[model samples]
Target: MTPTHETPTTPPPSGPVASAEDVELLAALGYEQRFDRKVSLWGNFALGFVYLSPLVGVLSLFAVGLSTAGGPSVFWIVLIGLGQLLVALVFGEIVSQFPLAGGLYQWARRLWNGRYAWFTAWTYICCITIGITSTALFSSDFVASLFGGTAQHPGVASTPLQRLLIAVAVTAVCLVCNSFGTRVLALISKIGLAAELIGIVLVGLYLLLFQRRNPVSIFFHGSSASHPGSYFAAFVAASLVGLFLYYGFEACGEIAEEVPNPARSIPKAMQLTVVVGGLAALLAFAGYALAAPDLEAVLTGSDTNPIPAILQSSVGTVGTKLILLVALTSFIAGVMSQQAAASRIVFSFARDEMFPGARIFSRVTSRYRVPRNALLAVNVAPLLIFVFVYFSPDSLVRIAAFQVLAGYAAFQMVVLAALRMRLKGWRPAGAWSLGRYGFAVNVAALVYGVLAMILLAAPTGDPNASFADRWIALIGFLVVSAVGLVYLLTAKPDRKSTAPEGDALEIAQRLRDRAASAASAERSEA
Candidate 1:
């Protein structure tokens, strides 16, 4: 007689809530399904766009860029846009292979080792958390301006305290939304993306067609600066405007686990996000620059926000406010996406037992299929830093931007590491890849990333600028990494514990056992 019974089956690891193909992919990577796979390709694309948030980055920083190097400085926007496309290509290859949550962190861990992954996650977490607070603060100022808050009317203008209150309020709403899980976040991001696209098209066309000041000259000329390298300095300073715009496209990669066929969708979504967002940003920035009635006057004037000033002149106050109201959704969407990506990263690190409270932060809620504790960790840490916004408000944006650039530089290093692995005969195992061209693309990404980092490191050419301001990126980089080192040395989490072996044969055995058990059950019932 054939065997009366078979060994107990593991039931195919239930609750994956994904197609068998997706489940197998995760299992091959040595992870069980922990998140609900609800986000679609467009949803992934939307999150990436929202993270870029052209309205927020372009509008808030346009005035600063103009002041730094006149109207022509918008050239940096286009240049950096091209450079970042190279970076995104390399990122696409990495995510295609890993397609894990914590995006950069997970990629580093898999590509190199646990130590590299720890520091990568640490830097990213710091950069994004600070970004959330600063972006919130930036949005609160715009919101305040919507209601007669201007330096022209000191008494009516929103005070620092009020701005802080609003910033905190915005952050709280983002936290609550994130707690609802990926489905809610995806819906909100899609709607926000629609609003952003509409605003970009309408506002850009209006400024370009009706309000062209000197469209042709705006691209070629660099205005007078006080120093010898002032033109170069101005260009460097303005590069931040574009640098800020290009990042956050990686946000899609951070939530890869929440998508089906992530290897295919995530990489495509990232590239498309960069391409679409880059065009939209270039148009928006160029439109504002071309539309400026008197670029020099606006740059030198006492108006704290020259973009709005230009907008007010071109379109009436009501029209400007209407545009701003739509832009506010971008800000809100940014916060939602930022929190989601950051929390996913935290969940990835914690699941690997890297942190002290690893087990806590790693726990996934069954209802939402989200990392509840990780969400709390990501938001609460940033709330503390938001308090600093009250005291040194001017430094917040600069510091946040610098931190992000530093993180990106380090992030590029991971791409270089992948290239090193490729040289050692590593082959692509993912659904998407650069084929034989991967090495060239990877090298280009490194070249672009290194040059961008050097440009970013250059000072603003202000002799009077504070030491902290001059080296803010380096300072932030050291502090974040130092803290990470301390924790890493002290805690010394076991690498093997968090580093799950990717044993395809082991997973296959489990599947076979489950299939055998199912067959035996049918025979008994028959």
Candidate 2:
């Protein structure tokens, strides 16, 4: 078959897109700069915000939190924001040093070695692909509710077949948009950000002004559910609401090569994403909590979808549909942003010839300057994951959330490793280093990451909590990491023809020398 969107034969435009210093920095880091550097600072911020898509997360998981704890669980959003701020800061520092396509994967590769880097890429690639399925399912649910009557239960009128079809349709649209490259992707992101902001402000104002309950103090109350230990267990389970809200900001750094002055711009973009997304989530969640006409009944009711229930009560049918329409648009934008970022991860690995299908996946289309093959591959995995959505929506969302958090944990561990290397005198040369505050910030990030990972993997006290879903995330991450280890030991991609060139290889060689010298010095002391 003829190539879809014929591959560009000419080299990328070579005008003054990036300064000579930028090219030198990238070369030193072990990669050729190939993408158009047209994304402005605001565009970069939009990319991160669009990926995080707080509106989508809050709407989808608001019920999960309400049912998990109670009104007070909404407060967990603030705590998660503080913790994720640390992660974002560490990310900012690292991405500044190595502002490349792979983001965390590239950072890990430089911090340690190829084997460690490969696994980082592997885990994240799997997580986001599953995440696409999750996004699609949530989008479909909202779409179904928007079209179906107010009296219908969330899923009553929408059959499994209909849900899956909507999901596939949404995913397909995202894939086509992604194939058009960053210009089009950026346009979608900007529009989505505007719609999402409008939705949050409009919905929050409507709820607070017109529909809010009088007893605002109820926001602090815990859930009525009984935990075997303490109610704190319920609190921990409820915190997943906030935990889920804070990711996808790192997508800012994932396409560093495509942004102008990436070293400086990527860091600020990440920080803005955290701050803005956190605020939007607070507005959305608090609005939902304060607006609910009957909190106890909504939490304990047969229809556990707090968002729609609350919206229906607050704004009635017409207004609820309008807001859901905005949410639906934001959800589509989210899928597009996610696919775009995930494709970069694939393209980064393939460009280095480390992945299994490197030659095919690394191809960037000449016409659009996008990774067509990798985008296609990225889009296909979600359809496969849709199999789970088709058969087991509840179980799959829980499990997929688990898997995605595991991926987040893996990235945090890599960040900690980078800190260790920094402690060992591996200085960062990026424009946006943390300076005197590096050690403190890195420690905070690591601590927060470890705690969040454990809490996310812990069993919930919710009545719907399952034994299997509780353990699946941690156990699955271990299995995937082990498989990556086995692949490294047997296949040894590091020793093959695909070894990275430029600054990364040079740095790896120096690290080995430093290790050998340190060992010899210890022997002499003995």
Candidate 3:
């Protein structure tokens, strides 16, 4: 009476056939295993690690954090990390029960309803579709720094053409890696993981040990930027640094079909990703902070991009350039992992035949055992975003800000659904679960998610900023949500979905109905 909508389908058409247990489990949930289970626990961890990419996060956001929050800005990492750890725990429980590919969409659908799931995916797609382009553009400068094709303007921005070409190239390379096979995706993740560890551990240690230019107390008191009247205000303004870094861990479960025993392994992988990623980011941030020759310059508006300066002054030019290469590698790996996550969401949505052109995007190439068309689909979408952002570089910065806001919005939808299910008496039945602590953890994650969203959406910190500039994140959220609403109403895609909604709640109701009917029959016989 669990509403086991058993999908009596042919054998898995792509990838190696799943083990009987895996196959049966997926079938019970209304899907057949279609991806090779090539990822081990470690490989899954690597995917999340590379996607989180401590080096990329710290290098990119350190200056903003430093300038706004001064030395005390470093603690945003700790605060946001702890908050995000709670989120990971909640996700751990959810993914344990529903380790389906497409991660957010799959989890949301089962916990809530099909309509809710469709919107979650729509908002999420908008986020990652632009996220890839922005991330690629961010790493373009590092790419140019090494390759020497970009003309320097001595503190001005790089040419739009330079950034566009390099970003496209980055997208192209990752597309190849992702389209080939699951094994190749895991390998790139592992390689990126190694390089990131060295960037964080080796470089961080050397910077902290050999290039220590400031006292440890710098982080406690902050700098001139946070001096006197500006202490609390400045710290609050720099919250994006931490908010941006703690995400990307969710990418771990997006390829649940490619992972073995994903229910157990993915939850562990997700939690490990948050814990290790947090520590690595803190290490890298502290190293750069203490090693900076002039902390005040970094904390003030003078040193806009302090990472390269700190590296150059602390290490020689050659070492700094080498680290840049490492950063570029991390960015590429991040793109690869992110693209995999995004494409799988499209595949999951399409397989239900609830999306436009579902047949095409859902196609899996037998040779690679991957959604080749979906992979191409995600890439092509980003190119359109690239074209849109090219004319107005300022919009590109706002796009970066909005990406995190959109992702957190989608994340909260899942959290809200899970909390609702728990209230309705559903318990997680997976290889991993929180047992008695599930409710408490779920509530806490919801609180954190809500507060985080408020922080992200509120237009504060910069008094000189215009309403549009300050409210960009909120504006972006509304625009994306509006578009999704229009689509949901117009297309009515949820009507076509075959996956069970309200998950166990629906199953429990069916059981109750069957019990009542049997009791009536017995009484009539008597």
| TM-score of model 2 vs. true structure | 0.89
Residues 1-526 of candidate 2 have per-residue lDDT tens digits of 1121223345645432566766666665555556767777888898889788989988878777776667788788899899989998888877877788988778887777777787778788877887787888778778888888474343323567887899899999989988887888888888888988988877887777878784678677776444535667777777878888888888898889889889899999999999999898888888878887667765654446667767776777787788888988899998988888889998888877787787898877766778889888987878876776678766666656665676677668677777778767765656787888888888888988888888777655545656666576676777777887798788876564354422333454553565588789999999
User: Residue 10 lDDT in model 3?
Assistant: 48
Error of 2 at 157 (Å): 6.6
Q: Please write out the lDDT profile of model 1 over residues 208-295, one tens digit for every residue.
A: 9999886567677776343345576666677777877788888999998899999899888988888898888878888887887667
Q: Across residues 219-284, which tens digit of lDDT does each residue of candidate 3 receive? A: 887554533477766777778888988888899989988888887899899889988998999999
For candidate 1, give the lDDT of residue 31: 72
Q: Which candidate's lDDT is highest?
A: 3
Worst 10 residues of 3 by lDDT: 148-157
- Candidate 2, pairs of clashing residues: 7-366, 8-366
lDDT against the true structure, each candidate:
0.76, 0.77, 0.82
TM-score of each: 0.89, 0.89, 0.92
Which pairs, if any, clash in model 3? none
